[model samples]
Target: MINDTIVAPATALVKQAVAIIRLSGPDAYQLINKVFSKQVEKKQNQITFGYIKDDSKVIDQVLIMSFVAPHSFTGEDVIEINCHGGVLVTTQIISLLIKKGARFANPGEFSQRAFLNNKINLIQAEAINDLVNATNETSLKFAMNNLQNSNLHLIKKYRDQLLDIIANIEVNIDYPEYDGVGDVSAEELTEKLVSLKAEITRIIKLSKIGKIINDGINVLILGEPNVGKSSLLNALMQEEKAIVSNEAGTTRDIVEGKINLGPLTLNIIDTAGIRETVNEIEKIGISKAKNEISRADLVLIVIDSSRELSLDTKELLTLTADKQRIIVFNKIDLIDPTKLVLENFKNERIALISTINNNIETLVNQIMESYHFEELTKDDSLVLANLNQISLLEKVENFIKNAYNNIVNNYPVDIVNVDLHSAWYLLGDLIGENYDDNLLNTMFSKYCLGK
Candidate 1:
């Protein structure tokens, strides 16, 4: 259990009318009472008028409310003070709390405590942080849904199912006197194992989609010199973010921007054109372009309609063959309608456009279709895959898979039991049931002072 009290600023640093200073832990109330003098009869759960003081000097008139232990966040007493939000005032109040025996809260300490105190599970705690950092409306909705449907509910369901299977196997082994063979058949046990394994696999697949939503997909624009690559980037961003020119190698560096497409946010990067060059700087630019293409979630292969397909353009197309990409026939306005050949790269995946003509809506739709952004729903729940969480889930899925294989191969129930129990332990680690001191210290230290 956390023995010390922690205090932090619960609101953003932006200029606001008022700021909330939160204190949580066993000594939350004690620290609050030290600096604040109640103006009215104070009762539990009631917000009373008060004036904060420092060494008998009045600071500001404020509203202070006390939440007693076990009913508040962190499962400890929580006290919140609504004080005037000037930076100086908030800093002075936090300094006063520190001097009054309350320690500074870490970057994510408040939520971390909630997790440790069994108030919320690992996923819900993560959701709280995700909601705070959400960049778009879709991301915020997903985080809210995840917080509402606690991860503990999902983990407990899986744990209970596994427990029932284990209990049945134990009864068959120990209570041979009872009608074990007829009551719980080996075939029924194998079926249940297979079903559970499938469910685990499905959840693991969802994590990939969750990762995409939590962190936007990266799309790199690649093409030969002066193929209107920068033009496309500017059009998609709805601004002249990237320099555009008819001269070859005008863009010598990568330009990056974000574009919201449906529920997906695409991080678009405009890279230097790929071509063999004798100039030292141009060669370096070419190398950087290659690297961007390799890491791209989608490659926008741009081709100038006025010029015939060049050797460098062919090379770029071949390089991006393995990546998810869409071909763009740009400068459509310059091309003669009768002379334009549509046979090559002619499909739903190819887009015809002209940045000058302002005809890139088709290209945007193509990107949305390629990434399957339409599939993400407003109501769908999303969970991010941080390193710690991904590792735990991987271990659990692996153990469940092993148990299912053993059961299907007609292996002994005792052998399958080992894998089943391993799965249980992995899930426990996600919710801090199997946490250690190092994990606790590492997690809490990320919080900022006065969090």
Candidate 2:
């Protein structure tokens, strides 16, 4: 148990209606009682109005919310004092708490303490941070589902199944003569393990989609100069964030913007047109554009519809051919939209667009459809957007598959149990049934102060 008390402002230290100073630990009540004029032995979960006085010097009027140990958020005595929102008033209250033996809390210490005390598992703890930082509705829902330990329940289901399998192996090994104990044959074991593998495979696929939904997609707008790349970016963003000029090479640097298409976000970046330029500054911008192309998750290759593809345009298309991209035939208003046909690149993702016509919704819908996480929402499946969680699950899948392969090879059940046991341990790690201190520290360190 933590013996020392810690305190920090739970709200931003700005001009607002109120500011909250939170404390948690064994001495939380003791520290608060020293400064509060109201009685400290109020019923648990009760809030009382009070005044903070420093040896008869009234510091501020406040509201004291109290929670006793083992039931509070951090599994300790926690107190939250809602004081007036003023720089001087908040600072004075914090300083008074410190003088009363309360140390300032570190970043995520509250949630870290909750995990250490078994009040919440690592997955749920992470959900709290993710919830606070979610960028869109989809990302918010993903984090919200995780807060209910949706992924934890899923891991527990797999854990229980593996434990049953391990128990069967133990029975077969120790009670060879006892027919009542029952044992699973190699063929039956293989079937069960294969079913488990298939479930993990589905989870892995969904996690990939969840990553796109949660982290959003990085899109690079690439083409020869004067192909309306900047105009398309503006149309997608619905704002004049990028300069739109008729002259070539007007966009000398990367212009970035974010657009939300309901379920997904596009971090669109417009780069300098890829063409040979004598100007040194334009050359540097072109180099940066090349670097961005390599890092982009999706490339938007714009082509002029009125003119045939130039040799340089064909080369640029070939460069991003292997990448996940959408070939955009821009300036469609200049051509017959009804007769438009991308015959050569029939297998590629193609979109006919006219930024001047404000017909960019087609491209937006295509991007959304490509990264839809509807599977996760339809069955109300739990989300595992965290990369660490997905990686651990993939490891579990590998171990389970290994055990299945062993059974298929007619190996002894004991040999199969070795791999099964390895899987069980990893599944436990996934739910944080067992954890490394350093791993927990690293995960929670990314949180904002007083989280």
Candidate 3:
């Protein structure tokens, strides 16, 4: 058990409505009792209002909440001082706590302590950080699901099944001479391993969707000059983020904006139009556009429906042949509706839009249709967002595959047991059943102080 008391300012140190100073550990109550004027009752989970005093001087009017051991966040005695907001009052209270024998808390120390006390597992601890740093609604939902122990429960289920298999293997090895107990054949073991591998592989594939949700999709906008690329950017962003002009080569640099499409954030980048230019700066911009296209998750190739297709546009179509792209025909307002013929580009995904007339919703819907958002969200709870967790899951899957291979090749049960055991330990580590101090330190160090 952790013996020393810890203290930290749980809220921002700026001028606000209130700031909370938190303390946890053995001396939590004693430290607060020394400075708080209102006598704190021995009652657990009580909130008392009083003035904080340093001898005869009054520091601030404050509200103090207390939690008894084993019921608190850290599974220890905990105190939270809700003082008037500002740097002066909060700092004074913290400094007074330090003088009263409370040491400053390290980053994620409280959460780490909770893990050590068996209050939460590794997945939940990491989820706490994810929840704190979540940028969008989807990310927040993903983190909250994991914090509720959804992933922990799933991992435990898999681990328990593996344990049963391992136990049966042991029974077979130990009771070779017993006639009453039937031996588990190699085929039966392989079947179980295959089923486990399929489940894990499904989760791994789901993690890819989780990653896209965490880090918004990158979209590149490409077209010849003056084909309404900037206009489309403004329309999508609902702001004049990029300067729109009829003049060619107006946008000689990359302009970026973000749009929320049904829980997904599309990081749309508007780059210089791809065309032959004698200007050095335009050439540099064109080069940058090519680089962005190669990295884009989705590419939008804008075309002017009123004008005939140019050689540059044909070349762009060929360049993006292997990429997921949409041929967006802009300036539809200027073209005759019946005169437009899409027979040449019928094989490619196409959208007709008029950016000036604010008719880009169809284009947005087309982009959304390309991703499997509905299916991904159907079972969105407790997605594996951390790279480390995903990597460990991959390792577990590989080990199971290896074990199945050994069984198929008629290897001894003892050899298959090695692979099974390795898989079990790796899954255990994912849930913090076994961990080293260095790994714990690294994981918790990413959290902000007082979390």
lDDT of each: 0.78, 0.86, 0.88
Q: Tens digit of lDDT per residue, candidate 2, span 1-451?
A: 4778999888888888999999999988888889999778845898999899999999999999999988899999999999999978998999999998999988899999998889988778888998998887788888888887655667788889899999999999989998758677777777888888898889888877787777878999998899999999989888898999899999989999988877677889999998888999889888888888787889998998988888868878888877889888899989898877678788887888899989977777667666655777643576688999889989899999889888888888888889899999998887788899889888988987788
Q: Work out the TM-score per prediction.
A: 0.88, 0.93, 0.92
Candidate 3 structure lDDT: 0.88
Residue lDDT tens for model 3, 57-105: 9999999999998999999899999999989999999999899899999
Quote the lDDT for 148 in model 1. Answer: 84
Residue pair clashes in candidate 2: none
Model 2 misplacement above 4 A: 178-180, 275-284
| Candidate 1 runs further than 4 Å off | 12-15, 39-44, 150-152, 175-190, 259-262, 336-348, 371-382, 447-451
For every model in order, what is the number of clashing pairs? 6, 0, 0
RMSD of each: 3.0, 2.2, 2.4
Ranked candidates (lDDT, high to low) = 3, 2, 1
* Top TM-score prediction, candidate number: 2
Q: After superposition, how far is residue 282 of candidate 1 from its true place, in Å?
A: 1.7
Candidate 2 CA-lDDT value: 0.86
List runs of model 3 lying over 4 Å from the truth. Answer: 178-182, 308-311, 321-324, 336-349, 378-380
